[model samples]
Target: MFGWLFGRRKQEKFFLEMMKAAAEGEGRRKLFEAASMLGIIIKGAGTDEEKCAQIASGLVNNLLKASGTNINSNEDDQFVAALFSVIACSHFSRILTSQFELSAMLSWVILTAGDIEKIEISNQATEYYIDMTERKAPVLIAAGNSIAKWVNQPTAENFRAVVNVFDHCRSMVGYA
Candidate 1:
């Protein structure tokens, strides 16, 4: 669902695609397993405000946690891509805070199996993510970088590299 980024030009294109995919489509239990590895509690939105930063960091760092079924395999690409898409939506949900509908919690998340309703919920959340991207939200830049990290080796070193770029984006002081 995303690409490995190199220079600024490729980064822009990758961000565009990541944002588009969010406007589209889950493994909640598996996701929690990965999240907990980084000490993220997955409090869902509307929980304690103090937990927001933790969730945010978890959203970013979990890219390297490899929440998919088979790490370093082609099969895992979709899994990681889906996770990044959901995290992108979650970032917007956190930005929206309240009145955000079910956008934040991934609408019961993507981990449940064989339950048609949950699958629909997960798909709906994806649509939410996608629509937000259509709106061209600024979070797309950082969100794209998070997914782009995986397109490379998916190592912590690469994760840190993308995160440093993300940090640089955050540190910008002038108008875009």
Candidate 2:
């Protein structure tokens, strides 16, 4: 699907330069956008690590051109929620992890708090994240306190807390 996405070889140097620029004010958003783009790009490469890395290299070449990174802008909320679906799907997440420092960047969504978390995602993204963690099950359960953080919504304040809890249990298997 993404045969045209990766045709060159230089990646680390390109990522380094992108990171340097993305560290600045406006550029940080670019990094986040690039992270999301990496997810999209790698998924198209299937389960082959070589192909995923190749497409990822292309991301480095094209990172500077990404736009519409504003998650809170107008209708981007829908995109964010849909991204949650992509991220939660095991097939895609596994493919995405096969390339880059993407796992690190994806934590951008997991570690999100306060402002960025405020973008009404219909709680879809957070719910998906919870499912992702749940799949880790007994292993993650041993992590205990670490996983509890995902259900941070107040028992009363947030309208979706109970709904999220029930939804998570619906597909959870064994001890998860």
TM-score of 2: 0.22
Question: Which runs of model 1 end up more than 4 angstroms from their true locations?
Answer: 1-26, 43-54, 57-87, 90-132, 135-142, 145-155, 174-176
lDDT of 2 by residue, 55-127 (tens): 3223322221232223333333333322332232222224334432343233233323234644345355446
| TM-score leader | 1
Q: How far off is residue 123 in model 2, in Å?
A: 3.4
Model 1 has an lDDT value of 0.43
Model 2: residue 53 alpha-carbon error in angstroms: 15
lDDT by residue for model 1 (63-101), tens: 334332222233233233333436544543433342233
Best by lDDT: 1
lDDT of each: 0.43, 0.35
For model 2, the local distance difference test gives 0.35
